[model samples]
Target: MAGNPQGHQEGAAGAARPVGVLALQGDFREHVSVLRGLGAEVVTVRRPEEAAAISGLVIPGGESSVMDKLSRAFGVAEALKRRIAEGMPVYGTCAGLIMLADRIVDGIRGQESLGGLDVAVRRNAFGGQTESFEAELSVPVLGDPPMHAIFIRAPVVAELGPGATALATLDDGTVVAVEQGNLLGTSFHPEMTADYRFHQYFLQKVAGFDNGTARSSRP
Candidate 1:
């Protein structure tokens, strides 16, 4: 269920702008809660118009194929792609990371993605739900204490293109988080933990983009 579309929150240059969370499916409510707690007006985006109203968006962890179908059926997929092309900041977590990848290694038949981040992702790279685990990742970009990440049937970046930079990796050197321009992606559920650094980092990207200080990474 989408949240009410009316509210004012301080953002870039002290301007008010809403941060949207794709609410067609998944743990969107968690993302919404985190963003709202961060003092930003949050919008639960369902329809295309809702997608258009936000300065930045967060695609939550959900079933990637189902999310893809619902977003297209609801007519928000194209709108989001357009916004990404226009340099709007976006943060994608877990399945959301798969949706933002340029290539999917093991997507279900006919499955599609929004395709913004320049990387190839292998769905279910860590196996089934029972294989889900937690890890403390050292993300230099975030600094200080390591980020505690939860992976639930998560994807992994198989091939990170030159356009994107790896933000965090596992002890085995497997890429789990990436960033490109105004876009950020992680194969773990940041919203599930107490740490809000990923969300805060994403908000900074949103602020920069909204202030016209962010350079578009799209080619």
Candidate 2:
């Protein structure tokens, strides 16, 4: 199913190019719509075999621990990490960022991550779901209007290595967006915003990967 260009809804096209939404949890539908709006096929990703044909993937915000457990239970965690390591572009939102991080300071007990990106995430560093909010960011990769970001129980990028580029931050200098290699992780939910710029940025990255124009950045 797809969403609006930015909300939770279903897609009308089944034959479009598939972009998998790690449907283990929250905001998966919202992401489906954003990818759909970008003219890609939108669908929920389940087992490892189900991920074979997708060119790109989006890991949506939710309970990171639950998502971790679910992905492992479904036996696709290794496949995901392997595919992304091989150059597939990925975008992670909120809890999704936590999933992509190498070190998680506040994740669920004994939870394992995809470990594809090198960054540290502090879960709920900006507060809880009730404290969720939005802000306008000067995301150059996005465009002129600035990217509108929505954060719900979001994580913050604490420290980055040489491969990471800080894309956006909060007033106090909290790291909220970082690009480590082909992986793009955002502490906010662009899928919940009116702006498709963030979606556009990731789409461009995916396109670059598809065309072999993407520069490798491993740390």
Candidate 3:
């Protein structure tokens, strides 16, 4: 959808165009709740047609391998890759971050990622779910007081290529958040917390893309 001069895209009835949550597998409902709370129309995407309709998409935290398998099985994987290549804004969290990485350092045998962000991610970099923890990260893009991030079975960016920029990292220097043009990924679950800045930041990218002002860094 072409965005209006104000950078808000609207549908036939003049409602804002929906932002999609990849619902094949993940904590998608939490994302939907957050997006709606931010005043954006949200749609749960499980099929190719749904994937094609959204101005932006959020891939939520879950089992990355499972999400990969289901997206391919449901024929939405290819559609999503195409959309990413076409400059659609996407925000991926935790397992969702793994799916968007170009190189998966520890993916299961035969596992595949949609591949857009130019980075290598190590699955479960912080051990297992029991090892999950929270940290206050310094994300200059978000600015001010650090973001309280919750990491659960999160993947860490092992190698960020020239095409991507690190947005936030732990004090120990582990990369936790990244941005590449219209694509954003985090090694934590923002939906699991009260902070909505990341979601709001992503919507701005969506608006930019819809208005034909977003730059694409697909690899």
Candidate 4:
């Protein structure tokens, strides 16, 4: 299947705009590698200022609470919320997906999120780390053969609003991927595997939509 991340294009001098992956936690390094492999400039998003120049952002998987705490401490949570609100293309996986959701189960207590995507998510809905599993999924946005997805302490989307679209799901009914306007999210980590399709798909979305332009809100 052919997948391309949006906004990135080959400049005449082989130049590329930088894309940043929120580095508060999770596999930020792997995401950096994945974006680089796609021939786009990559940067680690540690502070809001560092993220200001990037065309898009990826929120990597990790402890959702910790990410939220550090994001506030580092002043990124507000910036991220603002960026996405202003139209920066964002992608989140697992805990990252949880942060993007409108509501969370918060089994661990006092759970909070950035609440960008209009979806309700249950943390570790299919069980925690010990119950992690893999299955074939149909991601129509990617096309053709089912994509192999691995779920680790992942959240299952319970519901999404009219603006949201289901991009992929498991055979037994688990929302694996979703797109709400320029914001795209997934419960699985694509960087953990050899496939770069998901990342490419997100980049294509960013390039085409964000394009260094700030949108008023999620479309």
The residue-by-residue lDDT of candidate 4 on 15-117, one tens digit each, is: 5557889998887888888888887678899897876666788899988888888888898887788778867778898888998988886546776788778
Angstrom error of the Cα, residue 202, model 1: value is 0.5
Ten consecutive residues with minimal summed lDDT in candidate 4? 1-10
List the global CA lDDT of all models.
Answer: 0.88, 0.77, 0.89, 0.79
lDDT of 1 by residue, 58-118 (tens): 9999999999999999999999999889888899999899889989998999999999899
Off by over 4 Å in 1: 1-15
Q: How does model 2 score by TM-score?
A: 0.88
Which window of ten consecutive residues has the lowest lDDT sum in model 3? 1-10
TM-score of each: 0.92, 0.88, 0.93, 0.88
Better of 1 and 2 by lDDT: 1
Q: Candidate 2: worst 10 consecutive residues by lDDT? A: 1-10
lDDT string for model 3 (1-219, tens) is 122212356556675567999998789999999988887778999999888778899999999999999999999999999999988889999999999999999899999999899999999998997999999988889877788999998899999999999999898898999999899999999999998889988888888887778668665
Listing every candidate in turn, what is its Cα RMSD in Å to the true structure after a full C-alpha superposition? 4.5, 5.4, 3.1, 3.3
Query: Model 4 misses residue 136 by how many Å?
Result: 0.7
Candidate 2, residues 138-178, lDDT tens digits: the string is 87665577777877888899887666888888878888998
Sequence-dependent TM-score of model 3:
0.93
Sorting all predicted structures by lDDT, with the top scorer first, yields 3, 1, 4, 2
